[model samples]
Target: MWNTRFRLIFISSSTYSALGLLPMRPCSSSDPKPGCCPPSPALKTGAWHSHCARSASPAELCRFRSLGPGTSGDTGSAAIESVQGAKNVDIIVLLPKGHCTKIQELQMTTVLRENVHVFGVEGNSDELDEPIKTVFADVAFVKKHNLMSLNSINWSRVLVQIAHHFFAYFRCAPSLDMHPLPPVEVVVPTGAAGNLAAGCIAQKMGLPIHLVVAVNSNDIIHRTVQWGDFSLSKAVKPTLASAMDIQVPYNMERIFWLLSGSDSQVIRALMEQFERTKSVSLPKELHSKLSEAVTSQSVSDEAITQTMGRCWQENQYLLCPHSAVAVSCHYQQVDRQQPSPPRCCLAPASAAKFPEAVRAARLTLDTPAEILALEHKEARCTPMRKGDDWTRMLRDTIEDLSQQWQRRFLNLPA
Candidate 1:
C-alpha cells in the first residue's frame, strides 16, 4: 500500500506564475514564506500572460509524465522543489511504467516527499493524459478541488515558452540595426509540439524566425509538415529520444488555429473529426500556411546516435537523445549544402539524464555523481496495472486527499 500525505496549498489566480497556474516562489530555507515571485521579462511586456488561472479554483493540479529522458526529470524535480515544505499543496504525477529510462524514472520516484504523489501507469505518455483530461472535464469536481494542469496543455506553458523564441533570436541575430530584423531558424525537437507552437506564436507576433520541427521515429509532426497528413501512425515507435516517441502532436491544433486566422469553428470541427477518427487531412490553405510557417524533418534512431557521437567528437558536447534529434536536422542541412539563416537547435536536456542513449551512442558515460546517487535512493510509486481503472484510481486518490485535508482543517483526527 502507498503511504500518502496531503500537505497542500491553494494558490489564488492573482498569484499564478508564468510556468503554469502553480505559483512560483523563491526556494530557500530562510525565505520559507509563500508569495508571488518576480515575473519574467516576457511577462513584464504584458503580452503572453493568460487569465486561465484566474478562472480556475485555488487548488493546483499538475499532470506529469516522462516525455523524454531529461524533460520528465527536470519537470518532476522542479514541480517537487517548488512546493517543498509548503502547506496545503499536493502534486499527483502519473508516469508511464517501464517506458521511461531507469534514470528518468528514478529521478522522479526517488524523491521521498510527503506532498508529492507519483504513479506508474502501464501506458505511453499520451495515454497518461486521458485520465487527467477526464478528471479535468468534471467542472464541479475541478472547482471543488481548485484544479489546474501544469503540463504543455496549459496555455501558461505555451506562454512561458514563447520567451524561448525571443531569447534564441536575440542570441543568434547578427544585427538589430536593419530595417527588418534578420531571420533566425529555430530547430525544435518536437513531440507534443508545445515549443513548436510557441515558435509559431512568436512568428505571428512579428518575430523574424523560421521554425523547423524535428522529430525521431515517431514522426506525425514531420508528416503533417512535409505532407498534409495529419494522422496517427499505427503505433508509437519508441526511440532513443523517448519523449518524441508520440504519434499525436496535440499542439499542432494550436498551430492550425493560429495559421488559419483563429477560425475557431473550423479548428473545432477539424479537431473533433480527428478525435473521432484519429485522422484528418489538413485543409489546403492551412497546409500551405503550415508549410510556409514551418519546415520539418524526421530523424531515425541511427541518426540520433550518430548525431550524439558526432557532437561529442566535434564539440565535446554530449547531447541528450531529444537534442540530438534536432541537431540531426541541422547536420542534414549542412551536409546538403543548403543555404540557411543563422540556426539555433534547441537542446532541451542534458546528456547526464540519458545514460542509456549515451551508451547506445558508443560514447563514454559522463553522468554527474549526484545523478548516479539516485539509483541507491529508496523510491516508491503505486502501479496502475493493465486491468486497473486508472481514472477511478486517480479520482479516488484526489478525493481521499481532499477528505483528509478537510478533516485536518476542521481539527479532526486522522
Candidate 2:
C-alpha cells in the first residue's frame, strides 16, 4: 500500500550493474529479516487436455465501460482498434495451444522484425491445470533445440531491461514532457511471476516498480502471498484471470533473490528463512515489493464479456480476456474509489487475439460498427485441432511461412 509522490521511476547506469555485473550486497535491513525456507525439487507432470481442446471456445476477454453503474474511465467509446506498436523489440512469445487465437498468433509472429522471435510452446491449458508447471515442460521441449530457458526464471534480466526502459519511456512520455527525474511507480499484471519478479528487480534499481497483481477467483497469488509467512501451494484452477493462470511461477527464484536482502549472504539467510515460510505463502518482504495485489474480485465469465464490450464503447479500445479481467477488476475497484494510490494498468496483449472473449464482450457492445469490424478483421490462424498436435503443426507453419517468404521476396514460384 505504498504510494509514491512521483509518477515515474528511472534507472541510472548503476542499476544495470546490480542485474549481474555488480557483486552482491551485504544482508542487512533495518527490520529483522525472516527465516529460511526450501521447496521440493521434484516437479509434477500431467497430460494435455485434448478433449475439446480444438473446440473454438470463447476467444475474447473484454475491457468494458460499464454501460450502467460501476464503470471506470474511458470518456467515450468508438470501436477502438486493438493495436499497440511493439512494446519490446526482442520479444519472446510463448504460444500455448487452446489458448491462442489465429489473429494473436499472427499478430505475434507476422509483425516481428529479425529481432523478434515467436515459438510454439507445446501445451494445453485445460489439461495442465497450472500453466506455471507447464513452463518447465516447455523449457524441456526447447532444450532439445539447444536454447536455454528464457522462462520467467530469466526474469532477473527482463526486469533489468524493463527498469531501464522505464527511464526512457517515461522520460519520453507526454506526462513527463520529456522531463527529468520524476518519481515513478509501475503497476504490472503478474503472470508467470516473470513480470512481477523483473519488476521487483527494477524497483531495487530505483524504478519504483509496483506489482499490481491481478488474480482470478482461483486465488493463486492472493492465497500464496504472505509477509512473514511462506508462499502457498502450487496452484488452483478455473480462475477469472486466465493468463495470470499460472500457479507455481518459476520466477520464485528471482523473487527469493530480490527479497533476500543482499546478494552476498541473502541466499543462505533466505533458505533458512524459507524453512518456516515454506508450504504456506511467500514472506511479506517479497510480496510487498509487488506493491499491490487485486483479484478481479470474483469475476465471472459473463462479467468479463460485458467489461470487454464496455471498453470498446467508452475508450474506442478493446482488451483481450486476460487484460479484460485486469481492467474490469481494476475499473470496478476505482468506481468504489478505494482511497489507495492511483493504479496504472497495462494491457499486456491485444483483445483481437482472443476472438471468443471478444464475441462475448461484443454482446454488450451491440453497436453495428463494432460488430461488423470485428467480424471482418483480417485474421490468420493455423487451426490446430488440439494442443498436443501443435508441435507437428508448427513444422507445417514454418514450411508455409518459408514458401510465403520465398514467393513474396524472390517472386519465383506461384
**TM-scores, each model vs. reference:** 0.83, 0.50
- Put down candidate 1 lDDT per residue, 244-323, tens digits, no spaces: 77777778899999999999999999999999999999999999999999999989999999988886775566678887
Give lDDT for model 1: 0.69
TM-score of model number 1: 0.83
What is the lDDT of every predicted structure here? 0.69, 0.39
lDDT of 2 by residue, 1-414 (tens): 322111212111111221111111111222111111111112111001111111223441111110100000010000011111221112223455434454434434454343233444544332232332333356543343222222334333364446543543353233544344333333444445555565566556655333555555544454545343334444445433455555445455566666656563655565555545655444465556432431223355676777677655644555556656555655565455443333344444434335566665554333335334444554322333434554444434334444544465566878
User: Could you give me the TM-score of model 2 versus the true structure?
Assistant: 0.50
Top TM-score model = 1
> Model 2 lDDT vs. the true structure?
0.39
Top lDDT prediction, candidate number: 1
Q: Tell me how many clashing residue pairs each candidate has.
A: 7, 49
